[model samples]
Target: MTGNAALTTPESTAPQSPPEEPSVTVSGSPGETRRRAGALLALARFETRELLFQVQILLFFALDLVYVVLQMTLQEGMDDYPVLNQVDRATQPEPLLFAIAVLVCVNAAVLRSRKHGTTQQFDVLAMEPWRRTVAHVLSVVPYAALTALLVAAEYLWEALKPGAIGHGSLGELAIAPLTIMLAGIAGVLLARLVPSGFAPLVFVIAFYMAMVVASDAAAEGKWWGWLSPLVFPAYFPGDPVPADLLGRPAGWHAVYLLGLCAVLACVALLRSGGRTRAVKVVTAVALATTAAGVVGQLPHDKAALEAARRAASETPEKVQSCTEYDGSKYCSFPEWSGVRDDWSAVVDRVQSLAGGKAATTALTVRQRIDTSGGVEADTYIEPATTPGQVTVGTRWGGNRVPEFAVGVATVLVTGTEKSVLQDMCDARMVTIMWLVLGNDPSPAKTFQNVRLDDSTEGSGLLLTPTDGIGMTANQSTVVNELLERPHAEVAARVKEHWTELTSAATTTAQAARLLGVEQPKEAEKCGE
Candidate 1:
């Protein structure tokens, strides 16, 4: 009776273990897994929206637009210099802006929870740490996409503009987005590895400096230059990149960048979450694979590039497609035969100036297509009694007045003595200008359209006394006086003693004397 009574009493009621806490299983079912995934996606979308509306991002867009407009303006200003335009477009503002945006946005996203002291709260949730890291990284995708779209739009606008030469290929278009994504991944990994808030910015700035060094090295054709994603070959006004340089190497460069991005991503993933043995092993294997990919993408030896250029320059099979005029054989690549007529006309005019003396020289003229898609004229003259063998190639585009003048000057000066006197050079330049414009004294008709300008001080002083050469004001006065005479008279005087006049030893005053023109008493001060 006493034991039964005690059992019924509260104190004796079997000190019951606290109601078995109902086995709160934190492990989730499939539905819970799906819900967490949905939640992560929602979080990513929210973060992306926040990034898109940030004041910095909006300013970046405005600056990008300004850059494009500036580029367009500069393009118009440099229309005569195609190489400058290509270089300007290649190094445009898009790449720098994209990189900066990725670094800023990704760093902010990865550090958001920590900045707000919410990391521990997030850790208590059913979601894994690695999954959260991935969501934050994925949030950068829209920004990268937006950057790519902006780049594409700029390129499209450039292509649509009148006289616009497209800058890069379809493959190059991928470089911007790929580089941005790589920056984001790198930012995330840096955030995980470094405790300081400014770690990512420091790393990005350091990387930019490294890229500048790599770019300089790449210009020297070093293999390590390829390590920098921003290093790309620039095509100048008349120098185009070779087809080989643009082909397989481009693909390899893209792969190299992508592999770097993959490596950073895998390292970030391993460092963020559980760090399970399997994750470590997988990360190790991935690191090795990507490292190999990067090593394989290094550029081949510089000799390979030289060999390719040699191959491209070898003489073609169809040497018979040549035009002959005035003892000169003008031949071009079969595809470029259409330009022969224009070249022949210029040659005819030069021959007329020589008065049949040029016909005695055996000249072989060949047209070469430079890497920049411009035509170049290579002229070779066989050794003769007048001069030794002569070979000259045009520096700029072919068949233009400057090129023609250069060709004629090469013939005129080849057999003559060489001198570097300012007056002599000025005299020869004036003679060449006369030949280029015939009897026309119009400045616009001359090579490069060089002209004399009056100074702003209204002192009756002229600017550019001798143009690019050392043409003194006195020499310019003599040239103008000579041009005002009868065309036949001037041509006769020039042709009579062409050898003496073209000789570099002949000074401008001497030439003027020979042409029966009186020199000015004093030289006019240039830009007075």
Candidate 2:
């Protein structure tokens, strides 16, 4: 009896580990939370691996990579001198292919259990359906990360080049990865909402059509355009405005994309039965953040931009930095200092073939960009009314080189771009074209590039980088014949007949005969 009593005593009892605390799972306990997190991470890793193996995902990623490489290496123009700020946007379109792949793949991944008739089976697992939805959303992160790496690599490809100029924006750089995230999250949300196998295809087509329509407004910098995930800026490649003049709200736009991604993720979780207080709070916060970002990205006062533009155009000296290269004053935007040498080389070549007062005249090569009508607007840039000054555009190399060469010759032949703009249809055109093309290795090609029409003996418009001049048929005939002669011999004759050749009253026949070139019968049929 004493032994049984002692065994029955509470302290002396086996204690049985207090019945294991009834094996209760306290809701939101630390250990339980950690276990759920671990399960989520594991499931996400599995999904990411599955996505990596998809043929469509791999194919589109390869295509994006190839497109980026080709644009970097094979595209025409003076890409060696890339504007660093704009280089970040170069990869914006590249990720469209990869993002669509993610969209299709992530959508299929979310719908896999349904398609396989295993949705009920997955419900028996420790992780809830909302957690599974969260996992699906997390799975897209790795692909987004890969896209970020690709964008960074492309940017470095341009930034590392020896001639890259200007400063790149981190805000601008964030666009591609955020775009990928937006696409991937959108896929998960779509699958949860629609649950149809064809939903992704229909979604893609509809989304594409909407973006195509919104692109025109986006390209025009409309406020509503920022509603789109990818906004096309109002500037062309290799023709960017100064960093301060860009006026793009890239920082706010990045914030907008982040908010959009969060909103999509929360809605997807809610659709999958995540109706807890925490998720609801997150959803509210994300919506507010998105609204704030949208408000921040709206177009601001244009008065300041217009005032700045007028200052840049009317009195460029105040805004430009001056550098002396080879006896010429090159006034350009601060970022354009590196390109001054290239401009100076063209100027020296044009001036080398000139005679009389033109040969020794010092020139001012001012860089001009017209952002008044918008960065992408092909607005007419007025010729420099200032004497001894010539206009050079933000573009250089290829046809731009010879066109700029024409501007230099016009400034040399006449006092200012004003004189050339006044329809200088005289014998002076013969002398001007010679000065422009005499030293060119391919004079005929340069001539064709500088003119609107390809005809060798007809009236045509001569192109300049900033403006144009009219060329009479007689003037065209004389200039074309002179190009066929040895450059040195023609240059000597030009110097000997400089006065008559430059005079407004000199006839085309007199100019041609004096230069010892055959007078085309077409010269006699011209008006003056």
Candidate 3:
């Protein structure tokens, strides 16, 4: 045994030694061992072909390609579907791909568990350390190549097609490889690390749930939804959305996810360590590090985020003070600037009435729900899409105040009372109606530190802040009453509507109290 210490490359050359005397195992030269390892790796690819994981990967690839084909066909035929009319081409592709990727990850987890365990087919290879590692890794090669091809074709097709990205640019496709690579790594790495089947199942289920929840909230215009970076697709076709509203930083979020996959991959590496305490310590550290990495770059910019949040809630008056001429198309309402002191009273009232979300401002959205009419009106009234038609009482570029509130409780009253108030300005109902139901005073009142029921408007509504005392009992009745009836019939039906519409200016003292006061504060012809 001592004479053969330098050793032959094969175990077949080993000599027999006494049972009591331990035999010294000969380790080959480093360079030779490396060459042998490369040979073994190449051999592992042969084993990979026989592995069931290969079949699973191929099945998924075929299915994915087929699904893509089906989707393309359906989209082409969407002209026959009413629902597809509103389907945004730029926005729809992202969610579909993300959902499929998540499912693949789940399937991989299931197969990896069965593959690594006491499966008869893999048991022979599992007994050999190097063979197991190389073979398992090689199994993922097909999936990786297929995924790369899928992404490449998607971008290439989008480019070849005319006018693919307009409202939201699909330039994000440039980063698609990074995202897909990270996601694939995460899926495979998780399956490798937690081959228990249950962990990967739980992991993917939670990941998908978070994604869906985030998407729903974003659709509703909620700010919190932006925190879930996964909701947006890596690439979409449309005009470039603003950086301010990119939801979350895709690169940073992807980094966090990749870090998680690294930790899981390390866990898989140590699984063979055999109940050692050191293995336990390694696993614990990797898990802790992973958790930290995922949330580590969590915005320390609380102040910046707060500024964004506040800017979202601000009135035009407040926004004007902060404007630095950043290349934005929408500008501030000049007259509504720097009125902090004026809002002191209004803020108190809003705090009292606000409910639901912990941050009232979150609920008090500075939204512009552009109706079909609003879109049409925007053509004739350029300002309709600008600050002029805003019901939010705030402007992105305006000097909207940091402080403001509304008296929500006071707005609801008897039909007679509401109708009486609504009639004050037959033309100006919508704005004044918004003033009462909305969260802030009009920018026109920003300087005055008061609220104004500027004017109102109405259509086939039984009763709205826009309507006057001629309250039709129901919305259908109101529409029917107006359909063929003369103006005289409508005028005769509304009671003391003019007196009620114009009374708010004289009766209500606070800007918020304009809800209680009857009338359109401004005499402008508003209803259209």
What TM-scores do the predictions have? 0.65, 0.86, 0.40
Rank the models by TM-score, top first. Answer: 2, 1, 3
Model 1 misplacement above 4 A: 1-38, 76-89, 92-94, 124-126, 153-173, 216-222, 232-248, 274-289, 299-302, 307-428, 438-473, 480-528
Query: CA shift at 162, candidate 3, in angstroms?
Result: 6.2
Cα deviation at 89, candidate 2, in Å, is: 2.6
**Per-residue lDDT of candidate 1, residues 1-528 (tens digit):** 999776696666657676656754454678766888898898778777877777767787578767766865664432322332233335333667757766777777778878988878976786687877777778778767876776777666555544333245554566777777887777778778884678877887898899888866766657678788776443233333323433235556667776677677778887887486766776676567667656776666756665554443443224326777666676654433544565666555655655335435555555433332211112222222224122222222322334444444445444321221223343564465456555334533343333334211112211111112334555566666776677787778777767766666666677787777776566444332
Q: If candidate 2 were superposed on the true structure by all CA atoms, what would the RMSD be? A: 4.3
CA shift of 106, model 1, Å:
2.2
lDDT over C-alpha atoms for residue 492 of model 3: 33
- Candidate 2 local lDDT, 1-528, one digit each (tens): 999776686666645553344577797999989988999999999999999999989999998888877877796556777788778876787789889999999999999989999988986787888988898899999888988898898899888977777778888889899999999999999999999979889988998887766766866757787788887655455356777777678889889999999999999999999999999999999999999989998888867867777787667788999888767899898887888888888989889988898888889999887766777456778888889898987766677888888889888887788886666666778888998889988888778878888656688888886677887877888898998887778899998888898887987788888888997675344333
Best by lDDT: 2
Q: Between candidates 1 and 2, name the one with more favorable lDDT.
A: 2
Model 1 lDDT at residue 213: 87
Local lDDT at 120 for model 2: 89
Best by TM-score: 2
lDDT of each: 0.57, 0.83, 0.37
Which tens-of-lDDT digit does each residue in 1-528 have in candidate 3?
866766655665778675796755355678766866776677546544543344444564566677656645564311222111112223223434543454355435435447666556645552343234434444444544555466556444444443232222232332333334445445545655655546655766787698778756644445455445344433322212223333343444445444454454455445433344654675577567545544644545656744543453333334433222111122233322232223333433333332222113212112221212211122111112221122223221122232122211112221122233333323223222232333344432431222222222222222211212221112112222233334333333322232343334532222113222233343233231
Model 3 lDDT, residue 249, Cα: 38
Q: Candidate 2: where are CA atoms >4 Å away?
A: 1-35, 209-222, 234-239, 275-288, 422-425, 454-459, 472-474, 524-528
